[model samples]
Target: MSRQFAILGLGYFGSTVARELKRHQNQILGVDRDESRVDALSDMLDHAVIADLTDEKALAELSLETYDAVVIDVDGNLEASVICTLHVKELGAKEIWAKAHSDAHYKLLKRLGADRVIYPEYDAGIRVAESLNYHAMVDFIRLGERQFIVEVETTERLVDNCKSVAKLAIDRDSLFLVAIKRGEEVIQNPSNDTTLQAGDNLVLMGDLDALREIGKQI
Candidate 1:
C-alpha cells in the first residue's frame, strides 16, 4: 500500500529520503524554504513546495497531520530543525523522524516528540569502523545491547576443510546461522547437512561478541 510522507527539508539527506520513498511508490511531498532545492526534486516527488518550515503557520497550511509520516532534516540550522519538529508535533503529525547533528539535537528532538531521530553521519562512521575491524563482515545490524544480526562472507581458509554447515560447529546457545546467500539464491534455516561454498554470504544472528568471533574464523 502507498503511504503519504512529507519531507520538510530538501537538502541532501531529505532529498535522498524523498527519492527513495517515491521509488517505493509512496506519495511524497518535498518541501524546503529554498526554491532551488524544492525545484530540484519537483519531478521526482508527488508534490514539491517551497515553504518555510520554521513557521508553524506555514506547516499547518500543508496539512502535515494528514500525512502518514513527516521527516524533518533541517539540521544545517539547529534552531530551525528544533522548531520544525516542535511545530509538527504540535500539529499532531502521526509520526515524526528528525535528523540530528549532535547528541544535544537528538535529545531536543526526542523531547519535542519526534518518533525517531537519525544520526546519519554517526551511523555511517560506526558501520565503516565495524567493516574495517571485521574484515569478513559485510554488514550488520544492532538488535540491542550486545546483540546483532551480521552478514559475513565465507573465506577460503574457513571453507577449505569445512564443506558443510555441520563442520562449522556454531554454538547454538550464542550463535545461529540464519541463512546462506549464494549469488541470487538464499537458503533459509539451513540444516547442518547444507553444503558450504566459498564466497557465499552467511547471515547470522547472535551476541555481538559471538558474531565477531565467527567473523574472525571466516
Candidate 2:
C-alpha cells in the first residue's frame, strides 16, 4: 500500500527520502521554508508548501494528522528541529521521524515523541568502516546489538571453494546461510547439497563476530 508522508525540510537528506518515496509511488508532501527548495520538489510530491515548520499556526493549517508519517529534517538548527518535532506531535501526526545532529539531539527528539531518530553521518561512518575492514563484505544490515544480515562475495581464496554447503564446516549455531546469489539467479534457503561457485554472492545472517570470522576464514 502507498503511504502518505510529509517531509519538513528539503535539504539533502529530506530531499533524497522524498525522491525515493516518490519513485516507489508513495504520496509525499514536501515542505520547506526556502522557496527554491519547495519549487525544486513541487512537481515530484503530492503537495509542496513553503512555510516555517516551527510555526504552530502554519502547521495547523496543513492538516498534518492526515499524513501517515512526518519527517523533520532541519539539521544544524537544533532548536527549530525540536520545536518542529513537538509541533507535529501536538498536531497528532501518526508517526514522527527526525534527523539528529548529535547524541543530545537524539535524546531530545525521543523525549519530544519522535518515532525514529536518524543519525545519518554516524550511521554512514559505521558502514564505511565496516566495508573498509572487510573487503568481501558487500553490505550488511544490523538486526540487534551483535546480530546482522551480511552480504559476502565468494572468492577462490576461501577454504571451501566450489564445495557443497553441507561440508563447509561453518558453525551453524552462530551462522546461517540464508541465500545464494549467482549472477541473476537467487536461491533462497539453498539446500545443504547446493554448491557454492567462485564469485557467488552469499547472503548470511548471524552474530557479527561470527560473520567476521567467516569472512576471514572464507
Instruction: Pick the lDDT winner.
Output: 1
Candidate 1: which stretches are off by over 4 Å? none
Model 1 lDDT per residue over 70-177, tens place: 999994799999988999999999999999999898899999889999998899999999889888888889999998999989999889867999988577899999
Assess candidate 1 and give its TM-score to the true structure: 0.96
Residue-level lDDT tens digits of model 2 in 133-188? 98888889999999999998887866255487776657889999999999999999
Which pairs of residues clash in candidate 2, taking residues 3 or more apart in a chain or in different chains? none
**lDDT against the true structure, each candidate:** 0.90, 0.90
